[model samples]
Target: MPQWSEQTLASFERKAKETKVAVMVTGSIEAHGDHLPLGCDLILPTFLAERIAQKTKALVLPPIPFGESWPMDVFKGTVSLRAGTLLMVYHDVMKAVFRHGFRFILALNGHGLNTPLLRQAAEEATEGTDGTVIIVDWWSDLAKSVRAQVLESPEGHAGEDETSEVLAVRPDLVDMKVAKGARVRTAFRVVSASHREELLPRGVYGEPEGATAEKGKAIMKKAEEELLLLVEQLEQGKLPITEK
Candidate 1:
């Protein structure tokens, strides 16, 4: 895959200017669970962005290794950013990408909360630039694959689905011997009424009891196929997301 960070200024200018579309891959640094690493959010999107770039012909930027994760702050190693800071910094990055001459941008987001913030950044990137920006939540987009291939119930943090995915990419990071399942149905919003402790008692929200490397591979494969199709539609003027 052609990477923006690896290219010399001259080479980047030559290829990036002609490409017209680029993908900024990013995720958050937060707690998943006892069995997963703090970089779980960072790993999936960065890995998928490279694979997506191979087929999309768009330049891939180095993934942002941190994100806005207020809800998970109570957990150990749960690094987070202020919402305002994340919004402004992300907006600046989008503007910079547009200034570099890529008019179409796909912001591949790994963390869930970052999606709306990225959409805000994309709005700023689009103003006066006549560019198109879209945020693809890799996990949410492939929920079908998760349901069909991995978990029978909804997947949660460091749960069966996510653990399987990490196992696929970085199997050494998983210690299934200590893996556990946690399911909860919140009475209100997780961000507003319920914090991490009230929402996920054991630091997880989905089943991780039977996760495996093979299941992760299946989830990834399904996501790749679905996302590639979405990219094609975007090129044809169809947006993959809808406003609620």
Candidate 2:
């Protein structure tokens, strides 16, 4: 399927008339340890969305690169949007998409902190439109399967799993020298307070040295397969949600 931005009106109209699903991928600009680039989160969802477009013949919209990153604002170079503002942004975008006559929306998200805000936005969008929105946090949905396949530790926020994904997508963007001395932290140990200064001084939460492009490719492949399966189910009107 052609990306929404790249397609002509006729092409888009044709696709919309044939299959009424539109996918929006989003991510954040946050610190991802010293090894990975700040665009790590942004790239993953965008990459997966492109793959999804290729697999499911769905129209892919341009990704929103900046997302909720308040928790990691302590780190230099982290760009964050307030949760409320992001939610409204999502709502407006979703409404516009729905107004264009798409009846199905898949919100492919990569950042962990953006989950709650995205969920809220999805709820509001669903309430306001006839379209069905599916918010997908790729890592969360595939974490169990990834961990089972991984040989190293996996946790959220610049962990082994994320590192592996970056390795697979853009190896040149990674600095293995910096990842060599990376430190790991646990969410359970850090969530008692909102002060990241006292909790994670290193800006990382899990081991990243064990990441490899091969492993990343495997994980991403699995994720794409699972996403296609979900898309097929959604197309058949078998989504697992009970509306209020």
Model 1, runs deviating above 4 Å: 143-146, 190-195, 231-244
RMSD of each: 2.9, 3.0
TM values, all candidates: 0.89, 0.89
> By TM-score, how accurate is candidate 2?
0.89
Question: Which tens-of-lDDT digit does each residue in 1-244 have in candidate 1?
Answer: 6788888989887777556667887799888878988899999988888787788767888888889888788888888998789999889888888887766678888998898899888887688877788777888866584557566556678888899899999988888888877777876665653556767755688888778888888888888787777666665656666799
Q: Candidate 1 clashing pairs?
A: 160-207
Model 1 RMSD, rounded to 1 decimal: 2.9
User: Candidate 1 versus the native: TM-score?
Assistant: 0.89
lDDT of 2 by residue, 43-90 (tens): 998888888788776788899999988777888899999988899988
